[model samples]
Target: MTPRATTLADVDRGALREEAERALRALVGREDAVLREDQWVAVEALVADRRRALVVQRTGWGKSAVYFVATALLRAGAGGGEPSGPTVIVSPLLALMRNQVAAAARAGIRAETINSANVTEWDAVHERVAAGEVDVLLVSPERLNNPSFRDTVLPRLAADAGLVVIDEAHCISDWGHDFRPDYRRIRTLLADLPAGIPVLATTATANARVTGDVAEQLAVRGAPVDGTDGATASALEDVLVLRGPLDRESLHLTVARLPDTSAQLAWLAHNLPRIDGSGIVYCLTVAAAQQVTEHLRASGLDVRAYTGQTDPTEREAAEADLLANRVKALVATSALGMGFDKGDLAFVVHLGAPASPIAYYQQVGRAGRATDHAEVVLLPGREDRAIWDYFASMAFPPAQEVRATLAALEAHGTLSTAALETHVSLRRNRLELMLKVLDVDGAVRRVTGGWQSTGEPWEYDAERYERVAAARAAEQESMVEYVRGETCRMAFLRRALDDPELTGPDGAAWRCGRCDVCGGASAGVAPDEAEVEAARERLAVPGVEVEPRKMWPSGMAALGVELSGRIAPGVQASSGRAVARLDGIGWGGLLRDLFAAPGGGGADLGPDGDPGPRDEGLPVPLRRPVVEVLDAWHPEPAPAGVVLVESATRPTLVRHLAEGVARHLGVPVVGVVRPVDGVPPGRHDVNSAQRLAGVARRLELDLSPAAAAGLPGRAVLLVDDRTDSGWTLTVAARLLREAGAEAVHPFVLAVG
Candidate 1:
């Protein structure tokens, strides 16, 4: 049997343009909806010319329209018979994919998604795709690298895919604002594509550098097959690059400079209702988002928290609620940034500034898409840089650590991620990211058992990584400058992206006249004294429950640790308490300062630092919160004693906090748990298994006879300065339970 042939040689250009318009009208459900010239050009390039293209346009500039229109035109053959192969789109976030699928459906295109969240439906979706019952298939980049998917399904998909789409294409470049190593797998996909297949890469944020890198990657060629020369493949120079002006005229940008988190929260609570409509409240961390959500709810505003930690169902509900204007706002982290399509979103308020202007642009762009005017505010906080620094610390592992990982992988035939962590000090996330980077570099391969070395010699590319790090540092500084009102906020961001539209005939920068700086608007927008006081009181009243670890991390025994399975409920610590997370917007500042290294100022110093003892006891404000927590706790049977975890670094601070708590509660001070066996202070910089192992070997119980005698069936409060892994409290709780304490309640000043 002969296969049917498909060709574009007979395509009628005039009819193609008409069909493109019809497709756009169907997609947007508006007869007046039409394609911009650049959009048309992109469609023509893909459908008629069969050329790869990169479209760098603003968030609402109809980038998706270009691809959807192209998909429609390509699927409807030039001669009009059976459709072509399915369009494969590599999307980043599930939210984005869900939106894309709906949009495609509007255009009468059958679209399906395969991602981590829809595991049960994967088989059905795959069957549909293979049976030619699907028009478009959206998948995450991570799925592209999955062992089974890559080994079996992907090859078939790539071979016959009509068109390839890389959404959020900036992620293909390391210098992108939100770089993901998994996106680099797209290069392999591009290389393996059969000739004449058009590929499209789309992104809302990409500087000139990232743009060039993505374009180059899109032009990469497949290896020579069966001794045939592959040098004739098209180079990236031929790739059509459509870059549009990134100015969003409807967005009225402003920065509200408040003195502290309390003032920021107060301003938000007071002014959120004044904003035009439902939108997002961007936060820098999950804890900050949760804190902001709670504060807003207390102020009678309907808001929800949206972060990576949010349950999938809850996230979908929150998104739906915001879209329907049922909630005033969603206090969210970057998890809500990309590909969320709400045409009438009226505002975006950042509780704290993002680390980079590109990131800030992407987030704020979520608003003012369909409306004539929408508010975008940035409430810059003092702790922004600290949060940036913490993230920067995870950039790329040191060269030494990378070398050690490669050595370990080479020694072992195959090792799972958990097993690899036991051999290296890097955390699970960072280690996994590093391995992905290596895999793309051809230094390693993920097999059934785990990852194995490819025995390929690879250089660390230290200079390139250093440059990327330096670029990030520069971006951070620019973000600080943005908040400082050093220039027109809109112009500053345009220049940051190297947008050509911002340059005038005389070579001076053009101001959009919509930002607070350009409009001579006041940066101080604090609410009245009473409201500010209320917010301050709310933030000051601090206490967070530290849910105990139920089950130990899997594969602990592979690390030579015997601990495994669920923690015995009888010996476990009750849900504990912390004054705040170190990254929280409220008590975070004070707690952060309290936990700062002694000699290094505010820097996070490791165990090597002195962290000199201070004479100051627990602050008066903090003391009140501790008592408030105790009053609210109402632990059954009450705590009979207080047990302190001896702090090797901040001994003075820990001792003062313990004594203060004991005195306030009128409870006896039980003997402290001391470090033993010459074990060094537990390093907070390592992985969970390693940290827990160290804590298990180092900590020892030292209960006085009187305390021991009273511990038969009494509850005790175990206090510590801070917790990163919570292993310290876990081990300490075990020790106290072994000493016959009926229940252990762990409390800490902060949790990192």
Candidate 2:
């Protein structure tokens, strides 16, 4: 490595560019490495004028290059004396940060990161930063609101920081495809910075609206406290916005519509091997990703799975395996998206459609970054819209829920998230998200223990949320149009993102001589009929192990329920089976369709058009699979009779399913148990403690005359339409045991 550049204020402009080129060469370890014109423009803004810059460029366009180069210049400007305070990068994922730290090292810039994975070393990392031994310090967005970090460390870091970089800046904008509430805290971070500390924000997936939103946010010097308006700040006028065309010339885009999950898996098993190099196969859910991974490996191909639920160490190993080309592809969800750097990734295939074009573009951008040629394929499933709707339902909570959360915080003064769950109905994840939003809006504050209200009156922005919801709907529709192939796929995406380079100076539409629509669709090497049959059989093979709840959810006692800690082995339901998971790539599609709410958003509405799991009989096709799963299942102590758990909405379906299971087992229907009168019906979406509380309230065994005759000292099968949180099964099994049943075995058609 060459010696570091010294601070030189009198250097000529041309020489400054040359110095940047030298730093880039050292960074990339290539003598020919040079900064692109746009990259240089961003660096100059940060280094020369101390101005904010948002560089919206393609993946391979060296967005990281701009920041590292700027950091080098800013540090060198301090000369042999104390270097400027470290450049603090607010990154989204540890995977991204790790890759960036490696890249920074190549440039001789010492980069250190503090993320959830490396909590033990955070104090050391903080000490290094304080000593100016770190050039760039990467921290996750969540770190900004961490009480200790925010109150103690952040103020100092903000005051002493040379430059601040927000990687994945699109997340800051509500209009962006993947918005996070934690990212909103960046405005507070920026507002706290000392004057003249240049901030740089970078992203590859922002459309025109997101770009404006992010750029305005980067210019937070004189912006409003809430930023809930169109009022222009004087600082916004000065921020530099560097946007380039998003076209990936090396990518050959294709969208193939498949009839069902079986065909989609078959196509992947067939085409993945023929796609040349290692790449990615994205699924809409964790279950789907795991299934695809299993299918690909069973087809004698190298594959692995990456999802949000994967362990941290295993995720790192999987990433390394992919980067080293040890695996042909990683079947993954959006957890693999955003800032995962694999330069030579040859292809990106989506097993299902993403809800937004920009989000899809971001995922596909993973491929063809450094390669001269790469494949980008999307096999849109028939169930894409339903899956999209399922995810869309997880958006911001209702006004009443948000207000209730704030009220709870106000009433309690300060409550840990667990304690707060008792005061409000929202699940932990959704509740934390609401608290972050409240923190960002000045309605609450995060402290050492948990969260507290600021006693500030805040009105729900129903109109803004409605507008965002409308925008999301429009994005989904545009994605559908893209799948229909009404226009060139590349052109459609470019236009959707409002790419300024969609047209030339002559005002003609830009056309890429690639993609299924632009270049005529090809009959690519197809999977054999045998492969399709195998995939179908795999989908048909049912039985997802339904592990009974081993322990009660914490805080049940706080709700006046006595349950807590480990469930008694005597009362615990034996490990059982479900025909399939509601998120699986196999029977999941059928389950989703069967259990869909009236509006097609979730598995909530019954056939009577009411909320909760649908009240429908096990369909003829699903019945066979359920029976097969039971026939194949061998419980330790055989169930003596069926004890049907009466469903709030699906009583008929539960009875019908129970009868079929009983016929298969050669057992009698001995009992039927119902919830106590006026008890709240099954609530599937609540946190575990709340769900357990509801289960305790609702469960009361009223055995029939036949049960009275046969129930004593006999094992019974607990039947239901589905299991969510498995609380109902747990509590019901306890009741059955208490009613003189020797052992309880839980059976369900699906795990939703």
Candidate 3:
């Protein structure tokens, strides 16, 4: 590495340490604020020695202080001649960037961020960085890959950068929980960086494997980081690993094994107040987060819902409320993880366990950062594994699909994601994810329009993908083992994360003496009977508004379907209703069980050679709820008949539901909207465009005189087993309305 900053030997020791202490006082605004030994060591290494370092300390350990202080001294040319360029930091979340920006200002450092949320400020921010008015510039991982930024701004920044920082560095390692494909671009950035530019990588949750992986990734200085000829690179050329113990003395950890989702809800409602401060209640899915938020609010607790699906504005508002202690808690999913800091948060409760231990540690690390005492509780449910599997299904696609995607991009120089859908049947998210992975793999490149192949040979690494999958499965098992073990809770976590200091020089294992196993905590008591009953009542209430699809998916005609644009008001179905969400707290469990599809579960034809088998109508547990739904719903003109959306996979259930609803309405069972003979039965879980094209091609009303005569002329309730993307219900309703029915209203068992 080229040397641009001051050398360690030439600087006077006394003056340099005093200047560092002076900067620390200004950064923290404390008269007696002095840097800890390790913090001082890191600063000296970066500013004086000019070397790359990786610090893996627990939360609230002054890691951010190390970098900010370094930035201040380096910008002032502390006992040196030339001032360094702005320090570019690659942060993972907008919340983290906000916190960093504010913290930087407290230290008298001029900081600005460029992200999707602040697009209007990009030019101004860039100008400030160029004019040396800004000391620190923060950018998200995604912003690094933008064609404009990569081609224009990045080259200049790399040529003159004085320091680089990667926050939440654990995300850059695939072995770590919460691996992001975009973070892989950091390797390229490091390769392009000019020599003598000191770098720093920090995280609070990386294990031994993840730490090594991140160190290796950060060593790419225009060549392979891992030396294979005979010798490996030294610390001066790569990274200096500074790892400390991973334990929180303030956290009072406990595991409460609840019987079901309702019981877990009851426990939160009963105990949140007793914990005595504002905090967070975490759920596994968006549906659960919404359900818990609604139930808690109704129980007279002030709270809000925060999830991935929540609006960006609302997320900001919720974060502000939580920080200000305006609400008791924010019932949220993992979307609220990492860099959301509150000094005195009283507790962190999980309604469902995360898939891995590192993830759990990262989340709970948010709380008790500035406080000496806080509660950390886990309420594990049987449905946790199912939720994990659901998320795990979003991994890299098969080799065939990857090759097909590459071929399509090669054939067409530039294609938008929507136009690319014309060639591949994958959903938007999965397709976008695959494209990103391929981009990093050197087989494709994103451009002005969309994406283009790089004309590079690409081979799918199936074995490596398998290894990653296996590692994930093992982490899940470790999470399960954690809840069931009787050993030291803190030690178990440390070992899982491979904390180096866990087994100290004394050859003894470390224990927190504060967790449930250490007999320093207590939280196993059940909730009150009254609270449980109230939660049950709330769960038992059935109804979720299923909004109909307003516009058609783009590029449907490319897939041999003619539908496009908005559906006319005359043919569109009115709003609809469902019993509950498949991942909800009340009827959610029952519906999941009712619709569990195992090996052709109701998919094939019955033994009698009939298109749809005859079976018992509506399960016993669901009959009264269906009646309750009808009683609560007052559709216009009432229903003249019930028309079944032919479910080739669940025809028996669909037929039974149609017959039951028709009987209750005192009307006839209208003719079924059968699938066309040649089309394949499509899945309900794919993306909007793909699902829409499939439904349009598979479903239609018979035009034969005999079949047309059975159609209903007035309003009808269009019935189906479930609604996923809502495309099935929308397309089927349009077909029925155009055939003969005057109006359509959709009803379904569940909305997933």
lDDT of each: 0.82, 0.81, 0.80
What's the candidate order when arranged by decreasing TM-score?
A: 1, 3, 2
Scored against the true structure, residue 519 in model 3 reaches a CA lDDT of 90
User: In model 3, what lDDT does residue 183 have?
Assistant: 90
RMSD of each: 9.9, 10.7, 10.6
Model 3 lDDT per residue over 1-752, tens place? 45554355587656777888898998889999998988888888788877788899888888888899888888887855367888889998767888889889988899999875555457878998888899999999998789999889988888877789999999888788988888988888887776678889999999988998888887766755564421146633547788988888899899999788788989998889887779999998887787788678768898888877653434666787889999999998888887887878899999999999889998888888888899999999998999898778777787888988999988988887767887887888899999989988889998888999999999999998999889999999999998995788888887888887766654255678898889989764689778788899887656866656556654556667787666677778877778888767667777776765332233344443545433345688988878788777777867777778877666677888888888887987766778999787675434456667777888886444644675556788888888766677888889877886777889998877
Candidate 1 Cα errors over 4 Å, as ranges:
1-7, 79-82, 224-234, 504-509, 520-524, 545-630, 633-752
Query: Using lDDT as the measure, which candidate wins?
Result: 1
Residue-wise lDDT of candidate 1 within 554-593, one digit each (tens)?
Answer: 3456556687666788778887778777777567777777
Q: Per-residue CA lDDT of candidate 2, range 45-143, in tens? A: 777667888999987888999999989988987222235678999999868988999999988999998876555467788888888789999999989
Q: How high a TM-score does candidate 1 get?
A: 0.75
Which residue pairs show collisions in model 2?
27-107
Which stretch of 10 consecutive residues in model 2 shows the poorest summed lDDT? 1-10
Please identify model 2 stretches exceeding 4 Å from their true place. Answer: 1-11, 78-82, 222-232, 503-507, 520-523, 544-752
Q: Estimate each model's TM-score.
A: 0.75, 0.73, 0.74
Give me candidate 3's TM-score against the actual structure. 0.74
Error of 2 at 212 (Å): 1.0
